[model samples]
Target: MRKLSLLFSISFFSLYSFSQSGTMQYSGGKSADKAAVLIVPFEPFMYISEIDRQVGLENNLDGKAVKSEFAKALDLYLYQTFNEQFQVLSFYFMEDDVEQDLTYVYRSRKLEYEVLPEESTPKAEEKLKGIQTKLSKTFKKEEDESAYGGQIVTERDEKNKFMNAIISDQKVVDSLNNRYNASLYLLINQLEFRNVYGDFTQMEGNTYDRIAKVHYTLYSRRGTVVSKGLATTPFPASDNNLESITSTYFPILAEQIFNAVNMDITSTKN
Candidate 1:
């Protein structure tokens, strides 16, 4: 009985260790003479705000569930990219793991109408009466004596538009450096999602597509930006899974970071 218990414990520990070992190596790169290149794993801090609800999905899913999927996807991407040349050091930071005084801006704008009407003369009282009725229905009518008999239009636009929070602080940078022991850091500056309209003359069934655009920057220990990159990818409107859409661009981003690091290391040596 004692021997069986010991064997089971050893087996469980071995499996646990194997599961935890997340490293990848890339072939073809010059043999590493020194292990100076340390890659702090990519931390997904941008996904935190949506913790309570599902992102881009009709069904609501908690942040904890989404994180596991993200980890699996990220691990797969890193393994494919590095495959024998580089090693993934550790899963250092996650969105929920650290405290951040960060703010984000999400701007959305829609042109209400075409600016083609050029009428020099104001259409007088008759048309104005009908316009007033329509405006009243659409907007919360306010009485302001300044405008032609105290009428004012205050309402949300037919085309919804808004600019979200803006996050910027020196503390964020300092905290990142202190926690990771990394001299360089990466920041995801912009992530935009839009529906693009197009002419169907080219042969598509639908006249519009949903696209995602990402902009990011790399900063050195001195807070100097070393490099920046942008990527745009399209996703089918039917598949409104935000996680899936975002994961599509991860490889491109990982590659960009790898190339940037390679260049920096080479430049320093020279």
Candidate 2:
């Protein structure tokens, strides 16, 4: 009887560990045929360092330009890498028609800033302008060391809650399933870039490593949550090295994201 009880305890512990791992596969046979995933591009939500230690090509760092380039490159590499295991569905083709206006929530934390949806209207654009001013002011006041700190864990949990609501919308799920027969859904939540050396107070020169965090969610066709986590990678920090960053670290981040979900599925099945 003790031996049997010990076995049962081991089983419970294994399942508990799986739940905490931030990756999961639907144990029930949801899609028996094959893997087909539809990826939503990253929303315009980012947290970046405001320091001038790392100089750009023009000796000025443009945060907007960096965000735009990284968003596009990350999306491309993600699709390419995941296509190896699944029939990747491109949502970029119909982006404008399906796109919703976004409202920005600025936070001085790593991956805590949010770009949530609002109705498409002139007011939305006006509101965004105000938010941009606020973000700029906040960034201007922050140093690299303390800018992305002072975050409570609940902040991220709340953002994930909001993300869950978006991904679990039945109407959207139904539309995608009907239109593309997509069995899996991937949503890029947010991204952040930070310099490796935290203390900018004693900086000698310009060179440093830049680390990126790509937060994402994966769900089943029925809007059942599969996995949600962040994939991170570091590259040589250079403001003018967008080409190198795209060609190198983007692929690494993509592969990390893919393996995060794929390995979970494999482990759960076995």
Best model number under TM-score: 2
| Clash count list over all predictions | 10, 0
lDDT of 1 by residue, 1-270 (tens): 333234433433332222122322222333233231223332343222211232413324334434434444444454445434443222322243322312211121111212212231112212322322222234333243322212223342332222222224555556545554445444444333443334443126533444443344555555554554443445454443535544565575456545655675567658
Q: Looking at candidate 1, what is the lDDT of residue 166? A: 23
Candidate 1, pairs of clashing residues = 25-82, 25-83, 25-84, 25-85, 26-83, 26-84, 26-85, 103-167, 104-165, 144-150
The weakest ten consecutive residues by lDDT in model 2 span 101-110
How high is the CA lDDT of each candidate model?
A: 0.37, 0.50
For model 2, the local distance difference test gives 0.50
